[model samples]
Target: MKIASLLLFFVLGAVALPAAAQSVAEQQDAIVIENLRSAGSDITKPHSIDFFLYFPRKGQAKAAATEILELGYTVVELEKSPERSEWSVHATRTLVPELETMKASTRELEKLATEHGGAYDGWGTSIVK
Candidate 1:
């Protein structure tokens, strides 16, 4: 699963391709279907989204984000926390928590963060695009 996700991400995000291989309507339908699946039993609303990861660092956010981007991820936003002590970098591109390097506690991300003077804070989301 990790390999598949990684391959897909690199293929799609490593280069500047069209917005999506599928048409806009198809993408919207895909998002809606995934939302429905998540709801399971209720009339769930749909929202567009993607893979999400968080890195915390006061100064290293942009550097860390650049690295992830090199790996084919998309950095969405970066903001200093309410206390202004830590920075939060939100990113996406693919969902592959199973990667030995990306899995929590593996330290790959945390290590990367540290190199850039930060720490891998966390990860989030299930994405379809």
Candidate 2:
């Protein structure tokens, strides 16, 4: 009877989770797609950027990405190597915040990276084509 109850609870929890998770994911994707479309409207715009950082140890890369996102950057993606010593954070701005807003945020990100034994490698894009 104990095993039966436990199995029932697990089945119910599992059945309820996917729908919830998928809806949440779908909403986020819709928002992100809208932001991306708006941001990339200008051909000369350089908002799409990859911000790189290097940490002293494992797990710091994820921390770095979180901090950047907290600073109000539209984080597109985060890539970490197998060693987990580095992170490449992709950010694109859909709406203009204010003059010097990004500059200030970047300085803050740099400081945060330094605190984590990493360095902010600035922002750049590889190819326009």
Candidate 3:
């Protein structure tokens, strides 16, 4: 009877693992879709545009934002929070091609954030053309 119970427990654990994984994946996908939808609705431009966003820190968020600018998007710095000691910068650039490339990159970043289940403190966008 003990051996039978042990086998049952192992089988249940195996089944539970896959279900948990699928739930996480679904949640991630939902977040990605929501982000993309919101971004699409918020940006409209007749020219190319780019953006940079700064979070609570001056390191990773800043660097990631700069990297977006380097990808051929005009950078606009939105807000710098000096009072909080951490810069909350949001930059925008105009994109001539309507920001298809920028959207793809941002989507990838969002997915990474979701999978990791960490806070995404910064967000920016490229100008729509």
Candidate 4:
């Protein structure tokens, strides 16, 4: 009887999962795609970037820092949290002249961090005061 009940529960869960997935797919299909840029080119770009990342511990945070530098990004400054579990790194990449290209490179950085099993917090690029 116990085995039968477990089997029935599994069967019901399996039946419900497909319906949920289909609903999600339908919702996804309803989204409207928008183009970010519609012009030929843009002349404005940030000269530098500042990235701040928080991690579970210092070792992991340091590893991420090293990874970014390995990719040829110049490390402007690095400061670890007093608890030694987080880090704030400010780095600058030479302007690529195209804003879209710069955004794509940053997306690659995000993928690199995820590949190392770490989460990326956030980053910002603008003229320094």
Candidate 5:
């Protein structure tokens, strides 16, 4: 009975981990969207959204940039930070910053970063006039 209980716990944990992570990401997306709306930015119009990612190694950053480029994002800049000693990749894509769209893009970019031994820092954009 104890072994069975432990197995159930492990199974539940494994399933919940992804959902938990996604929930956090969705919450962040909502907050950013709300902030943008409050700032008088037109979320319905396509805006140049910038995504930030970081990798510990230059090779991983380069590989991630290639992948992001394939996803239709312009690789704006890829450089190593002298102070932080991490490779940073700034990519931009023009899209309407809807909540669902932002969430989906965040998930895809997060997955790509993870696969390339890096971290998807977050995203930002200027208020379109």
Candidate 6:
């Protein structure tokens, strides 16, 4: 009986760890999706979601933009910060704002940004009326 209990504990711990390892940005995606639903946005319908990526250099930002554009995101803007030295690329894609989909996209964007010496700063969308 003790051996069975120990096995169950390890199994549950392994299963729970992944959920607990969710990034803060992913968690915020869930909250924002819920808020959009509450605000009468049909989350199942496609919406224009904007993602922001920041880099220390303009070249890095432009490189990231080209890559994301190839990945099907529209390059909305690429500009340097007026107050700070960082450069930013604003990319948008139209997709259903489902939590899982948004989270997966966030992970991919984050990885892409990291590869380009930048960081994905998260995403936003206007409530679809």
Quantify all predictions' global Cα lDDT against the true fold. 0.53, 0.57, 0.47, 0.54, 0.90, 0.92
TM-score of each: 0.45, 0.45, 0.36, 0.49, 0.81, 0.87
Which residue pairs in candidate 5 have backbone atoms (N, alpha carbon, C) closer than 3 angstroms, thus clashing? none
Top lDDT prediction, candidate number: 6
Instruction: Flag regions of model 2 displaced more than 4 Å.
Output: 1-46, 82-87, 94-102, 125-129
Best by TM-score: 6
User: Residue by residue across 1-129, what tens digits does model 1's lDDT show?
Assistant: 999999999887956454354334333444544454575523232222243234455457777777867866677887776654577776664433332323322244556666777655454344422
In the range 7-121, model 2's lDDT, one tens digit per residue, is 9999999998865754332334344434555655442445454555666555676777677778766667666655654665555544332224435545666787777777766
Model 6 worst lDDT run, 10 consecutive residues: 18-27
Give the distance in Å from residue 12's predicted Cα in candidate 3 to where it truly belongs. Answer: 30
Clashing pairs in 6: none
lDDT for predicted candidate 4 compared with the true structure: 0.54
Q: How close is candidate 1 to the true structure, as a TM-score?
A: 0.45
Candidates 3 and 5 compared: the better one by lDDT is 5
Which segments of model 4 are wrong by more than 4 Å?
Answer: 1-46, 82-85
Q: What C-alpha lDDT, on a 0 to 100 scale, does residue 87 get in candidate 4?
A: 61
Write the residue-wise lDDT of candidate 3 on 27-128 in tens digits. Answer: 444454356556673333343323323355556555655554565544456345666555554545443323344445455444433343322343333323
Candidate 6, residues 15-98: lDDT per residue as tens digits? 989778998788888888999999999898999999988999999999999999999999999999776689989999999999
Cα deviation of 84, candidate 5, in Å: 1.8
Q: Please say which candidate is ahead in TM-score: 3 or 4.
A: 4
Q: Cα deviation in Å at residue 67, candidate 2?
A: 1.8
